[model samples]
Each structure stands twice: as structure tokens, then as C-alpha cells.
Target: MPAAVPLADNAVRHADGQGHAARFDAQSTCAVIVTHGPDPALLQQVVASVVPQVGHVVVFDNGSGGVDVAGLLAGHRRVSVMPSALNVGLGAALNRACERARELGFLHVLMMDQDSVLAEGMVHTLGAALVELQQGGDVAAVGPQFRDARSGELAPFVRFGFPFNRKLRGGPGQRVSCDFLITSGSLVPVESLVRIGPMDEALFIDNIDMDWCFRAKRAGLSLHGICDAQMAHSIGEQLLASRVKQDGVIVHKPFRLYFIMRNRVLLYRRGYTPRVWIAQDVPRLVLKFIGNALFLPARWQRLVFMCKGLRDGVAGRSGGLPG
Candidate 1:
């Protein structure tokens, strides 16, 4: 593999070898996971699922206090974790991990969310699909079909289509192209990251994947979701468990609401994001606002945060919300 730009710094890599690095070939893929205050038991399950599937694994401990990450998953020879003293936002944490993956000479990086647990052969399925898709040289990344761990829902892939956004039942490596994919369970070539750039740290949390995917499309690259490759993962938002008429509107906590609304506005202003998405998202936001206001927990507080996010986003503000 050719050299990639510098990526990691200040992450403490424990265990797994001699103070040196080895360069790997295109066949090598490293799983780079970002974790911050994750449940130890859940994190262990996530680590166990990934370790057997990849060439190497790097976990970034983004300021989770008092967690002995290494000890929790001790005796795993292929795993190495980087601990941080303070929390870096998801994008920045991933940037370091991807950089470290490159530094370790891996040709590909698998970005895994801390909560996502892979099914058996999921990595192989995704790897095979990626190898086949990238043969044409226009592929950006390949993600998996995920079953929502919370609701047992089989999520659909989406494409930007005329009249409305089209939900895909199939993905790239087939005839259709996916508009965007969630960051977790996605296999990205190291080279593509170099070309498309890293996640937008300005987003902090929400819409990071959308921002990256949109940028990739503007670069003339295509993303795919492999139907056979699957994972059990929970999305950030929860569907109302009661009689709330959500009507597909998702609600987050008040704090998360701020980032969702703010980063959404940020993405809306970016030239690289497709006009179709911009058109589609506005109504969704309206619905989300209404749903959240009417039935979401702490509705008033969430609304205040959301409106503040909108104001700040329009004012070109970025990063985490103020206290």
C-alpha cells in the first residue's frame, strides 16, 4: 500500500508487540473503534465480535473515566487500545484512529460504532463486496444492512431520486448506488479517506456520516450497502415506545437534539450535499420538531436547544453546544 497522510497523535497504544510498525498489503483491513463512556459489558461484546474478523483492531478510549479497557478485554492478542484524558468528539476520535490505522500500515479501515455487534462472516461479506466493487475504481465505501438492536427493524438503504428520496432494497455491487450510509459497519479504503477527507469534526456527533457521504458523492465516488453483510446495531435515536404518533419522526435527548439540528443546518449549507437531500430533510425536520414538541420527553427543553442550534448553525457556529 502507498503512504497515507499523517493521522494519529497522543493516543496511548497498549499491548500487541514490539515498539515498531509493519506495512500491510491491500488485503489487510483494520477495525478502528471509537468509545467514550460505553458500558464495559457492551464494549466487550463489541470487541469480541470484531477481533476475529479483521487483521488488527484499534480502540480509542475518548475520555471514558476509570474504565480499564485493556483489562476488560485482556488476553486478546490482536487488540490494542488508545486511552485519552479528555473526550474528543466522535469525528476527531475517529480521525486519530484512522490515522493510527494508516500509521500501522493497514490498507483499509473499518469504522465500528461501540454498540454495533457484527454477525458471523459480516466482515468477510463486506470485504468481498468491497473488493469486487472497487475493481471499477469509483467506489467510495461499502456498508452493511443493519438490524436495529432496539426494535428489531431491518433498516433500508436510501438513494436520492427525483420527486423524492428513494429507499433502496439493494445496494452497490448491484445496479443501484446508495446515497449515504451510516459510519458504523462500513468498510472504507484508506486511499478513499485520503481523497474524500475525514469526518467533519465540526459536526461533533450527528450528521457526520451524511456530511462525509455527501462529500464522497461530489467527488464522483459511489457508496454501497451489501445485503448479505449484516450487523446488530442500535441507532442513536429511539422510537417512541408509547402512543406517540411519531410517524417516522425520531427523537433524541435534549442535548443530542441540539447537535442534530445544528449539524443538519451545517450540512444544508455545504455545496457538496445533494439538493435532493436538502429538499427532503426540511420537512423531516419540521415533523421531528413537531413530534418532539408534542410527545418527546422534556419537550420544552429540547425545543429550546433545537432552536438555539438552528440559530447558531445559521450564524456559522460549529463544535459542541455551550452550557
Candidate 2:
């Protein structure tokens, strides 16, 4: 096990004379970042992008490989580091981080990833939209449209459908309602999370955003995507080019493939998960299984892991990958 790192440097503001207002504006939100084995340069860039935007920045290092998080973020006064000796998985880290933010009087949290860098005023835009949207009804969470920094490809928010899942690419300044939003670059109300309940820690990494969104939807809450608020996020390890109308594929590492396959089965069994999603996603998962096996390097190993994931998922297994 790695040594336990301190939860906070002098940067963390302890609850004291400080008071929190009942309603939160853009700058009052705290940012929760969960990390494991993050690239130092990318991590540094991620921190730089967020520090100036939020009230507090809390980084939960999920047993990183001696990444020197403190050194990388030394000069930032409002940032804190909560390092764990074990990789506690994204769901657990997010719960702990948000709890910390709540204790520090932040009304909302901007969920972030180490690889994603927010564009200027992105958090403010999401927060602003959330505040406005909630005036009409219960707003669970709001997120921004994230684009691949490498390719100029913009990602569209998704809604479950019968023959096709709806891809939303609303015009600028439009707030599009979606079934689920990715965790990164999302601005969520800490209170709404408290109501929706903590994230499903058992599944660990993948599909956390989906589970939470499903739960929120079940509870009669809504999720919105602010089309103008943008984030430069990297999905997968690389975007390889292929002639099939350009692969445009997001290729992840082999280990993540196991989690993706496993989590798919796990979420399918959940009551709150929309049945329509399970119905629609079946083909995608099948294609994913076949595509990864055929095109990716280490095809045999990925296939073996994917099979194990299926077996374990059916057996109701959860948490980290077993040795």
C-alpha cells in the first residue's frame, strides 16, 4: 500500500466563522476532482484551469503513483489534496470529496477529471444555468458540452431512444435536457446528491454518471446540458485513424475495457436504470466487444478480461479488478 497522504494542505479552509448562503451562485461552487495515476502535466493543467473559477478545489488522489500532487499545485491557495493509500474508486472518492466540500460551506460541486480542462467561464455557465433551471423545477445536475482537444469533434449529449439514441447538439445558449451527462465537467448540487443518495461505489469507475443520473430521473429530477459551456476533455487513451469513415474511435486501455463490460451488465440489473437504455445499449456493447477484440493491440488479453468481466458481473461481483 502507498503511504497515506494528508487530506489538506494549508489551502483547505476549515469550517469556522465562515457561513454559507442558502443559495449558491457560480463562484460559490466547489470542484471535486478524483484522480488515479494521472499524468503530471495534464493534472497541472487541469488544476490551473479550475482554480480560478470555483470557491474551493479539492483533489482526491486515489493512490496515484507518487505524482507529487502537492508540488504540482503548490502556489494555489484555495486548493486541497486528499490522498489515499488505496485507489478507492471514483464513486467513493467523489462522495468523500463532496462531503468535504459541504462541510466547507460549498452549496454545489463541479465534478471534474484529471484529464479534462474547463474552458473559460464554463463552471460559471453551468452554475448559472443550474440556478435558473431550478426555478422551474427540481434540477439534479447540469453539464457542459465537452469536445476532443485533439480532433475538433464536439460531443453531443445523449437521450435514450428505441431505434436510435437521440444525440443533442442544440444551438449556442440552449439548455438541452438529457437522460445522462458525463461526470466530468458537470455542475451538481451537493444537496441534490444528498437526496439522490451517494454514488454506487461497488461498480467503481465506469458508468457512475449513468447510475446517478438514472437515480435522479427516477426521483423526478431533471438533467440539463448547457450547449455553450464547453470543456476540452480527452476520452480514451488515443484517437486512432481508420478508413471506415475515419475510425473516430476512442480507444481506452485494456483494463478499462473490463470495467466497461462489467459495469454495463451491472447497471442493466439496476431498477432505476431506464429499460429503454438497456434495450438500446445492447448492440453498442456487442459491437464494443467485437471491435476491441479485432482492432486493439493485446486483443487476446482484452478478450480474456472482457469475458471475466461478464462472468463476474453475472455473479454480482463489484469493486476493483481481482488479480
Candidate 3:
């Protein structure tokens, strides 16, 4: 295959034994796209959308079932694919990506999922907002609003509020402070990573972002959300509408339920969880248990996973689910 070329605007090419690892100018941000058996077309779409906005893009594949990521990214010198033979979980993968970003001398890194597509000017807007927030005080990260790719529904920015609640805040284009932001589309400074520490790899998937955000807050850093910078992403398996509620209920697969329950329980036990989330989650968990039992298909299996998740979470069993 032909060698990849440098991107526009003085992008540097750092040669590795395998191929070239592109480096961007100091002003440019490094973008990290983590993938796990992603759909080929969607991955291409996301990569294409982000490459122009950032200086370098790392496509970190967490065990992609033999997908040829390098082959897919061929001819794009600024984009490189780093694949793992086994799934290292999202937190671990992101930590690795950040390390690579720092090694490349990138001041900031934008985290993205393979499935999500960036909106027009999303990266520029997020980068601008991050810089703007940093000028004020210690800002850990800045994230964009996420819209459901399927339904075109927008998710709200979140903040911890009175009465122990995680209140959704603000509409599009409005900048606001938030308790935690999703991993996807978050622009985090390398300095903050050094100060706050890497993601909690043990929890693996769920609540890792929240844990990081809470730690940043504890370290006197603020997390902000820029509503104008939006990403088209997926939240859950499905959205179930109800006449009694203004917002629909989100459903998830059994495996996801395991991580969701276990991670939250573990976070609470470790004192990493904010009181507000606990207050809100406790009642939500209770209702979820009942709802899944009464309505979801494969009811018994779902219950078993949830129970196992709770048990393991309490017992502090982590690093991929036990067989």
C-alpha cells in the first residue's frame, strides 16, 4: 500500500517502524476516536468528519474482530489506527490515547466514539470553548451536546443541583457549567489529565466519565458544556415513550445493564459518586429493577446480570465481567 501523507497546514510526520505517526502544530488539537467492532461505513464517516478539524486523529480500536483499521485509514497521514488484540475497556483505551497525545506534544485531546459523527464546526467550537474556559480558571474539560443519531433528539447538559439531583441544563449554543460530560466529543487538556489522573480503568465502561469529572471537580477544576458544539451519537438501545412522562425511558441491553449497575454501585461505595447522583440514582435503580422485571424480555436473565453486577460491584470485582 502507498504511504500516508501529511495533513494540511504544516502537519508533521513522525515515522514509526510500522508507518508514520503524524504530529500537529502546537495550536492544533489531537483527536482520539475509540472503536470496538465498529461498523465500517460509520467509522469512515466519523473519521472523515473529524480529520479536517484536528491536527492528528488516533483511531484506537479495542478488539475490533479483525477489522483492518490501518487499511481503512490508508492515505490519511494525520490519522493512524492503533489496535489492541483484547478489549481493554473504554477507560483504559482512552488513557492510552491520552498518553500518546502527550507524547506527540498535543496540548489538548478530543475524545470520540467510532459511532458518533461530529456536527459542522463541532471541533472548532469545542476547542474555542475550552480555550475560553481555561482563561477563566482551572477547567478540566469542555464537552459538546449530543443528539441521538436515530431520533434526532438532543440530550441535555447536566449539573449537580440542590436536593441531591443531577439537573439537565440549557439548550443549544448556550455555555454552561456541568458536573460531568460524556466521553465522546469532550475536549480535555493534557495538563488536566496529568493533574487529575487517568480514567478509572477498573470500572471499565460505565460511570468512568463521571468518576473522572468528580475527581476533576475535587481538584478544583470545572467542567463546561458548549451546546453549540454537538455530536450525533447513540445513548441507549431504545427509547420507550410513556404518556405519564414528558421524556421517554431509555432501555439497554443486558450486558450494558451489568456495567451500569455495577459501576454506579462501586462509585458510590468508593465515595467517588456525588450525593446528588446517588439520591437520584437510588430511586431510578429501584424503578429500573421493577420495570425490567415486569416488562423487559428475557426477564430472568436480565435480573441475573443485574444481581451479579450488584454483587461484584459490592465485592469490588472489576476489570471485565467475570464468566
Instruction: Report lDDT (CA) for all predictions.
Output: 0.79, 0.83, 0.79
lDDT of 3 by residue, 1-323 (tens): 32223333445444334231233242357889888878888898998888887778887789888787777778675887778999999999998987877776676789998888998888888876766565667788988888788767778777776545555657756898988898899988777898899999998898888899989998999999898888899877787787754557778988888888888888887665678778777777778888887798889888988988888888888889788
Query: What is the full ranking by lDDT, best candidate first?
Result: 2, 3, 1
Between candidates 1 and 3, the one scoring higher on lDDT is 3
Q: What pairs collide in candidate 3?
A: none
Worst lDDT run of 10 residues, candidate 2, spans 1-10
What's the true lDDT of residue 318 in model 3?
Answer: 86
Candidate 3 least-lDDT 10 residues: 18-27
User: What TM-score does structure 3 among the candidates reach?
Assistant: 0.89
- How much RMSD separates candidate 1 from the native structure? 6.9
Candidates by TM-score, descending order: 2, 3, 1
Q: How do all models score by TM-score?
A: 0.87, 0.91, 0.89
The Cα error of candidate 1 at residue 139, in Å, is 1.1
**Per-residue C-alpha lDDT of model 1 across residues 95-193, encoded as one tens digit per residue:** 999988988777678999989999888888787777666666567888888887877767888887655677776643453468889999998978789
Off by over 4 Å in 3: 1-27, 162-169
On the 0 to 100 scale, the lDDT of residue 149 in model 1 is 84
